[model samples]
Target: MAEETHVLDRPPEGANADWTIPQHWDRYTAEEHATWDTLFARQAKLLPGRASNAWLKGLDVLKLDKPGIPDFEALSDRLMKLTGWQVVAVPGLVPDDVFFDHMANRRFVAGNFIRRPDQLDYLQEPDVFHDVFGHVPMLADPVFADYLAAYGRGGQRALGLDALQYLGRLYWYTVEFGLIAEPEGLRIYGAGIVSSFSESRFALEDPSPNRIAFDMARVMRTEYRIDDFQQNYFVIPSFEELLRQTVETDFAPLYAEMKARADIPVAEIVPGDTVLTHGTQDHARSRAAG
Candidate 1:
């Protein structure tokens, strides 16, 4: 199983606050570029036909072909023309507020470093492999681009309403590890799954996790595990629909309602769930039994 890392809701220091403000773009070593290529080559081989059209299309449009670690300045120029979105380098996971603030303003953060080859299967903090390669291409999509920005705007509201947990679930199910139903079959769109080879396969083919419909309230109430493959994977009817429902809906009322309620456990199945595959909990139990 791939390991997980959960970032806090607030910045631990001033570092996360201004990561979007770029400086010193010419500092990468040749070894760093090699690292990006190594990771990129591995994921590329694994994702064909399994990843969404939007993801593949965006990858092509962005010209991820230049090789090595992408130069943010050069990459941002092309991305900015397409969606007004630009990737910024962060040291690691930023405070939740720092993350939200960046997203709210059309800025996408990526870890500035690449993962070591041995850590390729999993790492505690997001690296450039998990950031730029996993996330930037999707920002090129108009619908997903907007949905992310809206989620960022909703972040502060979630904090005030004490509904961050609720909103966080929406993020977990959608942005980080969500799936989309394509006419051909299920496709990968979430950054978390896309970046890792094992989870990419496990998320789609394994019977260990519940594949449920995306419900804003239900996702919020439900808890997620960062340490293992997710117990549940939310499936959207389509990437277009996923973006439409989330970006267009007003979350203020929803947050207010969730604030007074208790969170749902990862194991409970909710009603009205469009259950694609119900898990027996045997996969989860084996871990506990260990």
Candidate 2:
């Protein structure tokens, strides 16, 4: 989700009311397809042991291995059959309400463009690779699919309560940068981590960032960094539990409670946290000191 101020009053020219545009898959040049292939090849090599099983399986199920950027129609056809989810192209970021409404109904809106070859390591906005490669795989899992839909519904309600700040945190921590615990170990699932070459390693292997158990209340009150790697990562025990906590809880009171409390500092570990790793914050400090 984007900031409220970035939301335009209406859809820009050529976009639908929902801010969706045709993916225009045929229009992609050979160079753009090559860029997708390069990114895909690297991530494919790196993600097998590092990414969640569900995400890895989704990549196979979606047949993303074929050369060139995927045709959204083909991708959606497979995804819809498995999970009632379809990917739609958007000009770029959409308003929160539009985003929530689409996801609530299981339509995943993705940016239509891919990052340039030179910017492969980082890009300011989420491109098609981040949206499709990073996120769509997890959508193939039934439980994660339900959790996202639930989050979308929750986002709508949060808007009514003027609690989007709280709701957005849940999305940021879980959907974008979340980790999941498998019997083997903690694995990367969040799109932000899985899509990132650097962060995928840093999130699990590096000792500079904290890894903490997922707590809904604590997550809502905590701040996250968008300009750099997260100093903290929240790990869920399982998708089943994640969905259970999200669907069963009512957030109105939670939001009210959070409003009265101070926002948790990004790297601060509070008393009740189930700390998995007490990071040195060495990376953050060096970056700051640089």
Candidate 3:
């Protein structure tokens, strides 16, 4: 999700009023397709045991194993059949309202461009790989699909309530960097964790970040880092419970309550939290100390 002020007032030239443009899948260069393949292969090899069952299932259901960057048209055809979701291309990040509107309608807006080979490990803005590969697989799951659409609808309401920050935190912590407690162990489901080769391991195996149970109020009051791996991860018991809590609760009051409270420090564990792994925070400290 993007902040309203961070994007242009109107769509860029060549984009439609809604900020969408044709994916033009044929235009991707061999080098670009190779970059996608490189990223895909590494993550595919690493994620089998670490990623959530739902995410792995979505990979098979969507046939994401195909070579090169996926054609949004073909990807959407399969996704639309499973969960009424379709992938749309955008110049880059769209206005917050446009994003929410698209999500609310089950249309996911992805970047049309792929990252440069030299910048494979990191990119300031989300590219096709992050937007599609990171996010779309989970969109295939029924419950997660509904949860995202609901988040989009809630985002619209959040704007009216002046609560987009809180709502965005919900997206960042869950959709971006969340973990799920599988029967076998804590598994990665968050797009941010699953998409990157390094973070897929760091988020699960590293003893440097806190893993806490999901709590709506605590999450909204907390802040997160965009520059590095998360110092904290919120784990949900199941997608069903995640959806039930998100859809069933009204957030207006929650937002109001959160606004009155101080923001939770990114790495601090508070009382009443159901602590899972109390991290050493070694990574965060090393980064800071360096």
Candidate 4:
């Protein structure tokens, strides 16, 4: 079988220092708006019982349910009032420095493009739906908002230390694929899982992946994969706890120590793991056997 390829959209020639561009909202055709409406309506129906309260409330607070693709200006206006964060349109994925710089300054860089109807279920690169819909909702939460800003600052620092992989894992696990334990049960908070129709269900209900208690050291040392659903999802007790652990702890020493250690495989469960749900690995095994 041939490997699938995805060509990511790039910043137009002569993009500014921040690598941002106008959303040009009027440029979107009705078909594009219809696609957004379809994606929004489907996720809205699926998210209620599965998504974290913070995410659900954010969705409401931002008026994301309103018809058509969101106007970035309007979305930013509301987000600024809620959490001092604003979404900025970029051509697509920007350089790491440009990305972190925007986040550090409370500006989120989103692709101005939406996915085509044929590519609705999955797209390898983040389009506006994945960037804004997947990520921006959680930015409305104050605790997670602060953590992201801090992570951005940490990203800047990590760049100098050549320790981005360690920090990127923290993001992949928490911001993208994380879970949270609520009074009722496990709910989705990670944008990667929350934005996906399938992952939102799989991360919590599936018996194929490890669900372990959040541990700063363990998560930093772990590896993750992008082409498929995650093999592990870390569950946090609360956003406040998540913030405290990341913002308060110093990573300089930890980064220095990492040079001496081997990377932990995505599916390996080490000792002292506060094992929450022991995954059966049935999904992965089946895929491999096929």
Candidate 5:
């Protein structure tokens, strides 16, 4: 994994309170662009059979298949026309509130740098490739686009209620690692899975992780681990349904209830779960043993 060099919820010195910086599209070197090409080629090869139709369609619509690192201005032009969403540059991770504010405005904050070639297989911080390739494509799907905007709005509200943790898990399961039930089979849509070549396969084919139907309350009450493949993946029936659940429901009451309840462990398969796949958990056990 790439070293965890990111500044956590705090903005670095001289950064604007929101922690945004220029992408300096002109500054990328030939080596950096080449890194992007290599990673792009690797992911594009695997995505067609494994990714959601919407995600594939979005890739074409956004013209992400063309070549080397995409110019942010050029990318934003096309994205703005499709969904009013645009990519913005950031140094690294931003404060939660700043992140929510950007997303609320339909702006996605991406790291300006690309990982070195040696770091291709893993990176602790999100790079331009992960941000744009993994995430921007989904923004082209209108239903998902609307859902993101709603999630951003919800993030702002969660802040006032002191419930950001509850809301953050929703984003983790749905946006970062969510699966979808397509007519053909379950397909990957979550950006985290889409970005990682190994995870792209592991998330779908591995029987070591539980695949459960999306449950709003359960997702909110669950914890996530950042250092490894997720132990459980939540599958949504459709983007429309996911959007409806998040947009139509008020979360204030839900937050209060969640605070009164204990959190679910990351690897536990609780009762009442709509289990899609009962994982053997061998992968997690093997990792622990190592």
Candidate 6:
């Protein structure tokens, strides 16, 4: 009922910035590993045909079944073989620049804490459960891997443009919470959607949110909700396609244009929208009233 509390810079369960002591992988409690297993098992069960093949393949390549908090050194060894990307530990959400720097260098900063079992379905900030479980698997894919690094570089430029609102939308619509249309139907690829139980279902089956075809410009100008299920989901045709389009086209000029225009609210249906499902948005409205 109240505004979702913000707790930035809170280090994960056993993290410290010394970066010298090597990640004390042996320090994660047994209960903590069980938490990762629980979340991993739950989402693995739910994802089947729902998530993209790249994400699924990533899960296998990462060998995530070894359990407990993954030893970053081991995971990094395997990950480098797949996409040359490595995961590092972080406090919580770092400043935009720090996050972008890590991403640009192909180093993903994951929170060291696992979510409390009770917080499985949701958490205020990204924890190990959300960061590794949600994002690591997809990083194994080469093309999507490149896209993320590029986005990180782009983040730096976008910050300078005073267009973070638009740039953040780019991340919201694609990286964190997005879907891609497969030959069979819409499939989940975005880490944010795949990691949350409620959103996993809401994104694909619920009619409350609009499903629009992915449009770079339209998405950069859109707004998204951070605390709840998104009011809209942008669908891409394929990860490779999604990456090619974004990496090849420079967003510098695009950001310049977006800065001059009004940012679209979460649920608005615009004329140029490549609308897939035009919802009455009853679900979001009902929640608001309650």
TM-score of each predicted structure versus truth: 0.90, 0.97, 0.97, 0.95, 0.96, 0.92
Pairing residues by index, what is the TM-score of model 6?
A: 0.92
The sequence of per-residue lDDT tens digits that candidate 5 reaches over residues 1-290 is 12436656676666676787777888888888889999999999998889999999999998998878998889989999999999988888888788889998999888878899998999888888999999999999889999998999999999899999999899999999999999999999999999999999999999899999999999999999999999999999999999999988879999999999999998789988999999999999999999
CA lDDT of each candidate? 0.80, 0.92, 0.92, 0.87, 0.91, 0.82
Cα lDDT for residue 280, candidate 3: 100
125 Cα displacement, candidate 2 (Å) = 0.6
lDDT, residue 285, model 3: 95
How far out, in Å, is residue 222 in model 5? 1.1
Quality of model 2 by C-alpha lDDT:
0.92
Clashing pairs in 1: 10-95, 221-264
Report the C-alpha lDDT of model 4 over 63-106, residue by residue, as the tens digit.
98889889999999999998999999877767788889998999
* Candidate 1 whole-model C-alpha lDDT, 0 to 1: 0.80
What does candidate 6's lDDT look like per residue over 1-290, in tens digits?
01223255543344445221245577777777888888888888988888888788888889886667788888889899988999987655677877788899999887766777677777878887778878999899998999999889888887787878787888888888989888888988888998988888889998889999999999988888887788889999888888888788778888888878888898899998889998779988998998
TM-score of 4: 0.95
The collision pairs in model 4 are: none
Q: Cα RMSD (Å) per model? A: 3.5, 2.8, 2.8, 3.0, 2.0, 3.5
Q: How well is each residue in 143-173 modelled by candidate 1, as lDDT tens digits?
A: 8998899889989667677767778889888
